[model samples]
Target: MAYENLNFKKAHMTFDEGYFYMFDDGWDTLLQRLADGGTAFSYPLSDTIDSAVTSLEYDGINFWTLQDPGAGTITIRRWQVENSICWLKNTLNFSTFDSDTFTVEHYHTSLAATASGGTTDIQSASYGTVITSGTVLTLGPNSSSQYEDVTVSSISGTNMVLVSGTQNAYDSGDEINFYNNLWIFNNDGSGSLHKINARTGANITTYSDSEYDNITACTFARVSNVTSSTVDALIYSKATNLKYLNVNTMSLYDTMTMDNLKVNNTTIIVIYDIAIAGNTIYRLQKEAKYYGGDYSWTYYNYVLSTVRRFIDTVSISAYPTILPNNAVNVSEITTIVNDQYGDGVVNKPVSFTDTDSVGFITINPAYTDLFFGTGEAISYYKAGIVVATVTITATATQYD
Candidate 1:
């Protein structure tokens, strides 16, 4: 027969001789029989022997054993021999270790509860201070907790400077350049243009104002240069004629008369309020022969078709001069000339002759000067049309 339920601690301490039985616990049969007094000799039970023999003992009303101590303040160990046995024992006393020097273990489950895609709850059961609403926790320099409040300092620059909680100072020379969205000098008298940053008043760059001919009344209409280092500024003057300024040398480069600027047999008028739109220039002019009175306003759109058309033609021949050697191949020269004029001139043949070892080419070119016809009329108009043409001869210089 099998014993269904047995408590080893409450089993009989005395037993019959010449009989053997197995204790449910792991004690040796001989030790069990000796404890029961089944042997002839009497065996005295020591504290160490009894402690080792009994797996569970009464500590007050609870069944527990005095566990062996570990290195730390609180340690636990669990072991079982057979069946449905489970045991948990604390190996150390909380009152034995020093309170000030004892180490504590912390376990955290969720850290990013406020982050995006976070689902776990942020619990503050282990922390001393609970984090309520609007309280931000920050890490300190040495990994501790800290809180901070930020503030901005002062700002300073060339044209203007600002101090915290103080008045801002503005220099007399500071002015805004509306076209370029930058600050320039109002009247520096130094004949130099200084570009300044608007926000910080810092000096960004400086350019020579001599390109505008030391004339502050002139306005820049456009800038054109095949080569960026050498640019031509198209400037308009209120009192004088239109001038092209050389940016590199800062000098008056070229000039064109108002009469020379013509389109579709109409004398172009200078209008002030018009602005340059892309490759085209639009202007508003007063028509002298308008059906209405002279006070009538008329707007005219002058599309720079010739300017855009001749740009490729001019760039081809002009690009070579800006190059290193001042020389370009025959194909490039042909492309340059063809760009200026259409393909009609490409098929036309030319005759060339060499005289005095100088290369010259001649073509049938003729024109009539209607302004001065013969010696009879100092100022004359040709066939009721004010037009002029002349015969021209040209030569080309070859480079070695």
Candidate 2:
């Protein structure tokens, strides 16, 4: 690799060796150049527009102005709305002169709404107050004792008709009406419109009536699906309209009614691979074995005997043995006591002897031998044979 090292002695270097000299004076110019490139454009020092640019000009297509603060200083301000001018004068404290000329530019307008009768045909009613579009109207000073009344007669496309009246209540219903739907307020504080189904008599599913009283300020409840085999049941709440109550069993189910099934709370068991759809769940009791005896195992079955049966059926014949052939013998040793005052009394000491046969037996490896050998003799001998003996002596008395 070829490299060149150039050194400068002056603080500022002029273009010399066919390359421009970039001097770093502890400013961001070097940082910016290193970030992007040496030929990158530098950012502007100030972004505020000059305040002296004036002399408005209309170029037939657009209007603009340039302000000159004499001596070549210049500023440019755009012509905005009158509110913007007021804001600039009052809020921003911009200096204004009477010589500044305001120019108006020509634009295009359309009469589509007037020609199509889209905006003119729609009428308005009172919502208790008189108001107009694009025009402001103040409230109060009405003779009918009504605060404000403005009514919207119809709404079409992007246009609407509204009217104001002094009377609080109108002789006719609201000018606007929803054609297909009606609102109902439930007594339980919930309100909704019955869309898919209609209510009739005690049977809420029937749609026979054309003019049923509107269910306003009434409790709204859910009724589940009902079937001929079983009556629908409502699980909670007294509102029968919204819930499914089993007429036969008096049991309750949710909106989606189900066949009334008897639920035995005590007999309800949990079994594997079983699920509770409504009020029913089931379970199975299991059995197991230890030492080839039946043992009650709760919930699930753990079949040790089945495992043994499986082992027997297999070709593998090696069975697990828990104990050795030799039986473990446990003996208790006792010391005999003689009674003196209990009728049976003797002068000489009596001796008691006990002998226990201890042994082990094992089957021959050939599986032919039944009995092996006799056990060794175990004996216990007392000190002497005695009928009665009593000895008592007082030692010391201690006070507590």
Candidate 3:
């Protein structure tokens, strides 16, 4: 399928080992098998709905679609998969702002419980205090074996009061999942970020920052050595650069400049999207020159850098191989930090030191910049009749 004509709007990788590509040339969603070039199925939006499909998400079990019928109205539908067939399970309606893109993130919580359709209460062996009021949950295996999102309005003992009745009858020991937030960012460079409760469909908060302007795409990843704990950092591409934001702190964490970023000798024009699965990061970038007529798409996959660091340095002085005796000479040292894969690691700090304790050694810009992962160190020699030897070393910390 050609991705031209803005057909490839979103891609979702399910637990089934492949990806479901959503195309919006009037919207046609299809799942492609990665092991072989074959189609699992294709669902056309025009066949069932007249509205435009804005986003499609697979939450490890079933599928969900977000549609916009215009005028600040949005519709969300859940599709149940059973016996290799797809069934329309539920349709949820809401009134709010309009957006072209919607990102659904599953909160890190799971519980098993039993409940019936048309009921407002669900019972588990014991919920304890793990779930509270305003918390969003998803009940699995409805009457049609589908999943549905519900909000906990109140909690008492081991029971939960859902904001609304359950759509599908869930059995004992049925898996219940939780949802965190639904993100909708302005694609028009407004820097506005709107968050909605993914389970309750309620607007959580809205905020803005100039750093978030012109966002092209974003993904959640808990990259080691870059971010702390189990919290996933929101990696968003603004123009050609990628910025990392801590979701917990809602603050900037790090930035990756992609102006000269390349994969296999091809320079990336822009980053279209980013996705992370386990320790691997998948980035979709434009390989074609911007507005230059020739165009192509490229994919870059790499293991997250918890790799050991290797430093290579070269020192150059005014003299060819030896410094003049009884004269002052300056040497410029360049240090390049690379991981085990030989790829230059950017935005890393390097420390330079020399054995000279007589105060004639100095290093400038002791840290690497966004453009280059290199540092400079300058050393001076005092006028002396005796010959001496000094050893210089460059050090970069390795992250586990």
lDDT of 3 by residue, 177-229 (tens): 65466676654355677677665667788787665555545655445544434
> What is each predicted model's overall lDDT from 0 to 1?
0.24, 0.22, 0.54
> CA shift at 343, candidate 1, in angstroms?
23
Clashes of each: 3, 57, 0
Runs with alpha carbons beyond 4 Å of true place in candidate 1: 1-195, 198-241, 244-270, 284-363, 366-400
User: Which numbered prediction scores highest in lDDT against the true structure?
Assistant: 3
Cα RMSD for predicted model 1: 43.0
Question: Model 3 reaches what TM-score against the true structure?
Answer: 0.56
RMSD of each: 43.0, 40.2, 9.0
Query: Model 2, residue 169: what's the lDDT?
Result: 32
TM-score versus the correct structure, for each prediction: 0.22, 0.13, 0.56
- Looking at candidate 2, the ten consecutive residues that score lowest on lDDT are 305-314
Q: State the lDDT of candidate 1 residue by residue for 1-400, as single tens digits.
A: 1111111232211122332112223232222223222433322221121212111221111122222133323211112111222333223232121111111111111122121112112222222122223222221111122212111122121111111221122122221111111212222344444443322334566664543223322223333421233332533332223444443354665542222233433544343222232333222223222222222223221112221222111111211222221122211121112222221122222222222122112221111122332111011111211122211122221111
Task: List the candidate 2 regions with Cα displacement exceeding 4 Å.
Answer: 1-147, 157-159, 164-400
Whichever of 2 and 3 has more lDDT, that candidate is 3
